[model samples]
Target: MVASCATCQQKAQQVKAMQTNIDFWPTTLKLKNSSDLICDESLRYLAGKRLVCRGRWQQRTVAVKLFFHPKSAKRHWLREKQGVESLISNQLSTPSLLFAGTLIDGTPVLIFDYLSSAKTALDVWKELDNDEARLDLLQQIVVEISAQHRCGLWQQDLHLGNFLISDNQIYTIDGDGIKSSTDGKELTTKKRRNNLALLLAQLSPNYDHLATPAIEHYAATSQKNMRDLKSITEKELPHIRTTRRHKYVKKAYRNCSEFIRHNSLRQVAIYRRDADAGLIKQFLNNPDQLITDGTILKNGNSATVAQVTIAGDSLAIKRYNIKGIWHILKRCWRPTRAWISWGNAHRLTISGIDTPQPIAILEKRLGPLRTSSYYLCVHENTPSATDYF
Candidate 1:
């Protein structure tokens, strides 16, 4: 028993040490918002509980990303900062990390040297008029990925949006998903092939024609057998797609946030602190009124959806309605659908996949048992899946 106690104490100390190390940042380049700093009037990108803004520091333009989700802020910030540092140490092409630290409110912030002329490979691919040009670009990207593998690193979230084209060179961005092997060995043939296959799978299904030549070029440049590369990629592609879909379905049923629970004679409500307080108040104050008056997008026996404008910003609100007393009793112990959808959306965005930005979730219960729930999210005006096809 004494030995076990000592072991437990040592493990506690190790965890404490790790947390202290993660919270530490060099003070040499710490920034303060003052006359010297100026930010652009509008945001450059906003998704996944984070926002990117253009700003000037020391007269040089920079991109500032603020990660606002408490649950993921520390992990994402550390992964991105460490990944950039690792790539730089290995002499790979990536954005220069200008500064990294936390804001006064404890939000993690990272500043990077801005590339004004850079365009995401997704945008460039959409503009290419011929297959030859597209194939050439794909070959260049494969070469870049090969270089990373040579350095014993691989980006788990390999997607077109993560590749940036500038000055005829392909540069990588969004380093949070990059990983390295734990055994200190060089990347093996299997690992390299899997990485290539994952990258190809992220492209639109319509680009299936480019897979053959792209794999052949990669195998040639990397000095691997073309047939081996083709065989591995063909087997891995379907598995990766199936895994992605399965992950989404699994995560959609889990609660993803710690919500403030409130109960009263009339209803029960739960919300997050980061969410807009005014909106939550309006929602809980009269959920029935909002459901009846808000513009309904869909209405079914199980649920209802509406497009609600609160504080001048449009939001998509989904309300799960109980069909009968039996339904309420069956679901009272399970997580609300609103909570599930919110978690799934956030997970998709953080994985470098596209989804609507989730705002908040509220549940109204009978006594301690949840009977109705509402999920609120930013109403994206982008093209639907059918439109893209």
Candidate 2:
């Protein structure tokens, strides 16, 4: 009878906490172990479900993660706690977890020491200009990853963004992605191959030279004999790339983190989320005028190509001009070649192939029918691959 009442009270507390709105920042909450926690800035947010914020706790600035969902929150909370504990037990570098427990009202909360000056590995990699520096960075990253695999753990969503650099050290973040495939034993050869391939697949084939040395370093650090290292990565990289390409292609036509999608009765548009919205709007509004003012690359009857500079970015715009009334009758009932190229370009990108990024695709439409379409991409000054080869 006493146990039943405790369970009921816990449920009640969770319900009360769920009522507390998380969308607004500078909100205060009572922590069970420390002072009243004040969440001042949202570092990352996922609607009503999860929030990572910088907050004040115990007279110190700390990072706080609050899980608002009632049913699934506890599971994720325990996973994060277990992941952090695993890293600590394995002597891997990660942010120290200060506290892990429910809030006063039973909302799951985790507090950690915040590294103020840390930059994500992705940002640091982007700043590196030369291939040698980039290779050195990759070496350091794969070595750390090899250590984790040896310790019987690997990040399921391994990527450069999950690592933080501070004090000349790389600290892995996103505890939730840390997964164990073995019972405190080194990962099996198959697991190591797949995990390493997943990370390598994120890089273009232009980095092919880096992959050999990186895998060699992994084998050396993990003490694993990978006589078939070349065969493994060769077979696995394409498979991973194809899988990722398929997934990202599905996101190309929708509003996701990487792409912005807009649709209307008269027009439909899709663009990269990181693209300059003002420039895109201006170009789309007066594409012909811009093409007239910009440098012309091609001026054929059925198509036109122009190079334009916008917001300091050199861009190539191609307009698939409407041929005539007969062309409209056939093309208006279906998607244009430009739309196809836009999706194909994204496929190439996701497959770790070198190609200019497809920034946006716009189409003129009558209801569901499509007419003239435009494809936008980053301008490349190099010679065509066929001619160069």
Tens digit per residue, CA lDDT, model 1, 1-389? 78755543453343233223434221122344422334453234232345566767778988777665535657888998988887888888998998788654345778889889989998998899998999998999998888888788899888888888889988888888878778645588888878887887776556778988998888888887776778755688767766765765454443332335555754545455456778888887776677677798889998899888878888888888889989988998787888677767755663557676776667776666777888877888677779977
lDDT of 1 at 97: 93
Which runs in model 1 stand beyond 4 Å of their true positions? 1-37, 41-52, 65-82, 98-110, 123-136, 180-186, 204-206, 249-287, 294-323, 334-363, 373-389
Please report the candidate that would top TM-score against the real structure: 2
In candidate 2, position 40 carries an lDDT of 80
Candidate 1, residue 161: how far the Cα is off, in Å: 2.9
Kindly give the number of clashing pairs for every candidate: 0, 0
Give the TM-scores of the predictions, in the order they appear. Answer: 0.61, 0.75
| Candidate 2 lDDT, 122-148, residue by residue in tens | 899889998999889988999899989
Q: Please, what's the RMSD in Å of model 2?
A: 6.7
TM-score of 2: 0.75
- TM-score, predicted candidate 1 vs. hidden true structure: 0.61
Which numbered prediction scores highest in lDDT against the true structure? 2
